[model samples]
Target: MAVKDAAKDEDDDNEVSAEPTPPLPTPATPPPSPTQEHIPSSPQAQTAQP
Candidate 1:
C-alpha cells in the first residue's frame, strides 16, 4: 500500500511537471500597429473629403 501511494504521488508529480501551461494573454494590438492604423486612416479621410 505504501509503495502504491508513493507511485501515485510520483505520477502526480510527473503530470504536474508535464502539463502544459495555459497561454498568457498577449496584447492583440502590437506596437507598430498604431502607426499602421494611422497611416491608412489619414489617406482614406483625405480622399473622402476631396
Candidate 2:
C-alpha cells in the first residue's frame, strides 16, 4: 500500500512536471511582471488622460 501510494504520488508529480504544470507555474510567476509593467506605464497614460 505504501509503495503504491508513493508511486501514485510520483505519477502525479510527473504529470505536473511533464506537461501542464510547467507552463502554469511559468505563467503564474510571469503574470505579475505584466501587472507591474502596466503599473509603471499607467502613470504616463494618466498624464495623457488629464
Q: Top model by lDDT, which number?
A: 2
Considering every candidate listed, which one attains the maximal TM-score? Answer: 2
List model 1 lDDT by residue over 1-50, tens digit each. Answer: 99999999999988876654322223433756897998999999999999
lDDT tens digits, residue span 1-50, model 2: 99999999999999878898677788789889898999989998999999
TM-score per candidate:
0.37, 0.42
Mark the regions of model 2 whose C-alpha exceeds 4 Å error after superposition: 1-26
lDDT of all predictions? 0.76, 0.91
Clash totals in order: 0, 0
Q: Name the weakest run of 10 consecutive residues (lDDT summed) in model 2.
A: 18-27
User: Candidate 1: minimum summed lDDT over ten consecutive residues — where?
Assistant: 20-29
lDDT of 1: 0.76
What residue pairs are clashing in model 2?
none
Q: Candidate 2: lDDT of 35? A: 88
Residue 2 in model 2: shift from native, Å? 25
**Number of residue pairs clashing in candidate 1, backbone atoms closer than 3 angstroms, sequence gap of 3 or more or interchain:** 0
TM-score of 2: 0.42
Report lDDT (Cα) of residue 42, candidate 1. Answer: 96
